[model samples]
Target: MMHTSVGWHVEMEFREDDQHTRAVAMVRLPDGSEVRAHGHASRHQTDVNQPRVGEEIAAARALNELAMQLLTKAHGEIDQASGRTSHPIHV
Candidate 1:
């Protein structure tokens, strides 16, 4: 992959307190503009036990939100460049 297309990077970090996890995504557009997405996940339990099902679900949701945000931002940038909108045509 070329450096140009590789505009986004994903980072996931787990905190030591309250099973908190954070995911940050950063992207650079073609116009040399940068955007960021942030998501935080947390579990209630204090133990390190393989992340319970609910915890996994929460983490997944957080990551999904972060991904969607980043993609939406990128799509917006592209749409602006191409002069497009989210509205559909009426027949």
Candidate 2:
């Protein structure tokens, strides 16, 4: 498993399998904002109905990227609504 962060936060996992692999991403913003995303992909030698571990990772990365983009947009909206200075907060 690996942890990644952009405007939001993301997590990905890899497993050994000939079938499809699964991945998930999550994001939390200020003021208790939260969102989640997921992806799955098939691998070589695996049925199209199933995804490989690498494919799963790739899907997860894509989902995370989307989450980050959403967070970035939402963050801007939140800051604008609250009229708060742009600064990273520890939570």
Backbone collisions counted per model: 0, 5
Clash pairs (backbone) in predicted model 1? none
Error of 1 at 56 (Å): 4.2
| Candidate 1 lDDT by residue in tens digits, 1-91 | 6555444554443333456655554555567766555556666576554444434554565567666765677677778998986543222
Please report, as a residue range, the 10-residue window in candidate 2 with the lowest summed lDDT.
44-53
Local distance difference test values of all predictions, in order: 0.56, 0.60
Candidate 1: where is the Cα deviation over 4 Å?
1-8, 16-49, 52-58, 87-91
TM-score of each candidate? 0.46, 0.44
lDDT value, candidate 1, whole model: 0.56
lDDT (tens digit, per residue) of candidate 2 on 1-91: 9997646445555443565565656556655755665666556563354444466566656676655667567678889999985654422
**Model 2 ranges off by over 4 Å:** 1-8, 13-16, 46-56, 59-65, 68-91
